[model samples]
Target: MHLVIVTAFDYPDGGPVAARHLALTAGLAQEGHRVSFVMLHQARPPAGARSNPAITWTSIARAGSTSPLAWRLTALRRLDRSIGSAAATGAVDAVLAAVRDPLLLEATLRAARRRGIPVLHELLEYPDVVRPPGPLGRVQEQVFVRRHLPAFDGVLVISGALEEYAARSGVARTALLGSIVDTALETPLDPLKLTTTFTVGYAGSLVQEKDGVLTLLRAAAAAAARLAPRYELRLEILGDTRPAAGLTATRESHRLGLDGRATFHGLVPHDQVRGILARCHLLALPRPVSRQASGGFPTKLGEYLATARPVLTTAVGEIPRHLRDGETCLMVAPNDEGALARALVGAASSYDAAREVGRRGRGLIDASFSAPVQARKVVGLVESLRGARP
Candidate 1:
């Protein structure tokens, strides 16, 4: 099947979103599906960006000197033209969009309707769940969720919570496509050797409310205190330090007396993350319990697991369903600094046992969450949608 994938992620080197799309599209291409990846917001490819010969990449640059509404309409017109051109050649089987804008979604539906093709939405998170919006944004999201979402021919959700939400929102066809990683790209770390410095690494947004970076910081401080004179604790954070609001991780680290021990590598390219993470003793995704946490799965978790590093994360969302507490990963309660600290200390103390658990977690990802595995589900969904199409 030939598929047109529309997304808002920056192409080639844009962080996790771009990585996720690239992995999925590469898998589709490997399955003999022609993929056209259309970037809705990126103007041009990044410097030193590499191309995939199997997939075609297109970018819809923002129009100059126009009102916000006019820009959206212009972008929609460009997208419509792209879709029509592909449909005219009988090359497009379906349109899979990972877009959040309601106007764009509406325009996509109208364009696909005209081209006699079905449109599928890749649902990652509810708009109002993870990031709370203003009043107008809230109203817009409500309209998008209740009205625009159900208009799609099918919806691909990333987590069980989102699948349920899609069903409740009246979506007829829904498929769960969780966080995907190309395990082939990952080289699991060899058995950990006893080291004086144990590093706990985290990648993703540093937002305290979203990723619980502050909690992780507090836990790291507590764990460091507990480790005392035996071992030195180091915290390595990757991603943006600026938060949407509240205390920044850097500031919190200083306040918690972890200024010397914590190192913040702000926003590196996705390709370099694995190499950096592999050097760490343990990886963490201490996401606190919230509506957003429940609704979405972290893409970084798959990447962390691929490194075969003991991942310490909370039992929230669909994670508990896939990973066993002591068997696969070290599970802890959300937002609990004490529990997180204890878990970190335990993992650091029992390095050999934790390495084995990390290996099992990696096995789980290889068996289930790998790019090829999830991409097959997408192919199946596209085929079913094509079959149902008149």
Candidate 2:
């Protein structure tokens, strides 16, 4: 199939957002599709971003935040020419506007409509779920629920709950694809490769929405105070650090006298995280209530399990369905300092028992989370659209 993927989220800086698309393009290309990734951001799309030779990329720099009047108009004009060029000969099979931002979703839908292309909007998170901000933000959110949704040929949701939620909003053709990860690269590391430390780790943006970062901080403090004097809990955080979010993540570390004990490895490239997972004993994050938590599959969760590390999470949303507490990991309530503390203490007291949990997690990843499995499922979706005629 010949395809064009439109995304509002900028790839290079959006971290996981960009990486996922790169993975998808590669996966689709390997499956024999001609793919083009079009970013809403204007910067030169990163060179060699996709491994699949059949995949290409395009970008439109939103001159003023991608939402402002001038920027939106300019983008639409550029998009008009681009889509017209792609479909001029009627050769394109479909268009996928992976809707991460609501405002741009409307534009893409309108453009895809003008071009007479089948469009699929991947709903990993919703406008109500993200709750962006201000009058314009609310307008965009409502637009997604009221207008943008109905414009697409089909809707792709990452969770069963999300599919039902979309259905309630009168969305038809909604399908739950769950979330995806390249699982082959995610297999557990050799036990001998890991250098054990009394450590608890969390990776990804230090943003407050996730909730897991804070939970990990409190748990560390509790573990430090409650554990044997010889067991010093070390902290390892990976991902981007924004000032607003960093203030909180760091404040707790200082108050707990964990300055020297904690290490913040900021935004290391995607592959570097896998290597860090090898030395990690436990992956901690309890994002119980975030929109992403409830509506999407976290890529890191699969990676952690692949590393065969025991996870201490709230197990809410897709996390619970994917990770079984006691069997594969330990679950605590979200944002509960006391519960998180207790879980930490328990794990510290019985490191060997915790190791068993890690083993189970790795087994789960091996059994169900392989990259081929994820790629094939996605390919199946695209294939289903192949024979439909206008």
Candidate 3:
């Protein structure tokens, strides 16, 4: 199948969204599917950014637009043209869109409809989770999710929660395409090797409300004091330290007396993240229980597991369904600093046991969360849609 993936994900080296799409597309290409990745937003690729030769990349920049209205109009026209051209080639099979904007989503549906091409909406999270919408935006989101979403040929969801949500919203066809990682790229580290300092690493957003970074900081401070007698504890955080809007990790780290022990490496190249994670003795994703946390699965968790490093995370969302508490990873209750701190100390104390858990977690990734595994589900969805179409 020749699939067109339309998204706002930054090209080359962006964030988790980009990483997810890249891995999925690579898997699709490996399955002999041709992919055209269309970027709706303009982003400057950072140094050391790399591209895949199997996929074709296209950018539709909102060039010289002064206002939101103007940019939306320009984007719609350009996207329509782009889809039309691809449809004219007769090689394009379907369009899978990861766009969230209601207006743009409607435009994409219309464009695809005009070309007799089916459009599938990719649902990553609950509408209210990510940058929460305003009153007006909420109204738009409701209309889109309830009325517009069901109108798509199918919906591709990233989590079981999202798949159920889509099905309840009257979407006839829904596919679960959960958190995926390129297992081939993630080399597991030896669990028995001892480092001078026991490092707890976290990659992704540092926002308190998002990933519960403040809770993590407080827990780390407590863990540091307890681990000091046995081994020095270091905290390594990688991601955008300067969020557009939210609580910053650095200020909280200092307030919690972890200034000297914590190191923040602001957004680096995507390929380098796994290597850095492998060096750490432990990885964490202490997301608090919230609508956002339960609705979407963290892509970083798959990467962390792929590294075969013992992960300490909360029991929220679909995580418990895929991983066992003591078998695959160390699970703790969300929003509890004390529990998390204790879990961290326990995992460090029983390093050999934790390493075995990490090894099992990597095996789980290969069996369930790997890109190739999820991509096959995607291929099945597309073929079913094609067969049903008159």
Candidate 4:
């Protein structure tokens, strides 16, 4: 089968969402499907794209102006044309779009209908959860929940929580196409050897509100002060550090006297992330309670599990449901600094046991969340949609 995946960002971009798509695409291709990616707004072949060799990328033209409105208009026009052309020329057999913009999604549906092909929407984030707090957000939510979703043949959600959201939003057919980790690429590392400084790793944005970067920093500082003699703790946050939150977080770290204890490796390629994770004694995913947190699962969580490292994350969304609190991964309440510090201290106190828990987390990934596993489910959904098309 030839498949086209539509996204709101560039193909194989440096982020967790792109990582999820690339992993799924690789799995689909490995399952003998030719896949292509169509990016709506941004289109610059990521410097180090890890997409499968069989996966092709199509870039749509964009407006010269940098304004958000202009970018969207140009993106919609180009997306409709590009998808329609591909469908008409037999370059694609089915459409799998992961777009949040209503207009871009409409364009994709129109293109699929033009060729009488099946189209499915992949819901990574519930729009209502991430939308800005304003009337415009309500309007967009109505458009997505009432207008766009039911029009599609089916929906592929990132979590069971998201599947419920889709069902309530009037989507007739929904599948839980959860996040996939490329365990083959990111095999579990051996138990980390004791070093002078215990490294706690985090990968992704420093978005203070959503990812709990601030919380992690404060917790680490508190933990370091308390456990000064036992083990020196350091944080290695890897991702794009250009956001304003990064600067603010850095200032806070210094204000908390964690100047040298916290290191930021800004925006490395996806492939190198695993090597960095391998150096860490523990992985931290201190996600706070937010709209995105409630409806979507983080791709980094899957990767963290794949690394076979003891993970410390908040009990938000499907996290606590999917992973055992004391068995697989350490669970802390969202934004609870004291709980996070205690979990951190506990992990350090029983380092050997935490390694056992890390292996257990990896076991869960192998059983249910590996790339091949989730990709087969996604391909099954796509095949069903294709078969249902008249």
lDDT of each: 0.81, 0.69, 0.81, 0.81
Q: What is the lDDT of residue 255 in candidate 4?
A: 92
Question: How well does model 4 score by local distance difference test?
Answer: 0.81
What's the residue-level lDDT of 267 in candidate 1?
79
Q: How many clashes would you count in candidate 2?
A: 4
Writing each residue's lDDT as its tens digit, candidate 4 over 1-390 gives 788887776545547677887787777777777777777666565655544567777767463556778777877777777787666545576788777777787888887788777788878887776566799888988887788888888887888888987788788777786668777777898889765678899998888877999999999999998777879998888866777988888888889998888888988776677788888999999999988888878888988988889999999988887988889999989989999998888888888899999999999998888877887886677667766766
Clashing pairs in 2: 42-60, 42-61, 183-371, 184-371
Candidate 1 C-alpha lDDT tens digits along 48-89 = 434555577667757352465765666787988877766665
What is the Cα-based lDDT of residue 339 in candidate 3?
98
> Could you give me the TM-score of model 1 versus the true structure?
0.93
Question: Which is better, 3 or 4, measured by TM-score?
Answer: 3
What does candidate 2's lDDT look like per residue over 190-274, in tens digits? 6632233577778886876775677677668777777747577788888666577877777767887788888888777765777
Give me the runs in candidate 1 sitting further than 4 Å from their true place.
13-15, 46-51, 62-71, 88-90, 130-132, 189-192, 244-247
Q: What is candidate 3's TM-score against the reference?
A: 0.92
Compare candidates 2 and 4 on lDDT and give the better one: 4
Candidate 3, which ten residues in sequence have the lowest lDDT sum? 42-51
TM-scores for every candidate against the unseen true structure: 0.93, 0.85, 0.92, 0.90
Q: How many clashing pairs in candidate 4?
A: 1
Q: Candidate 3 regions off by >4 Å?
A: 43-53, 62-71, 189-192, 243-248
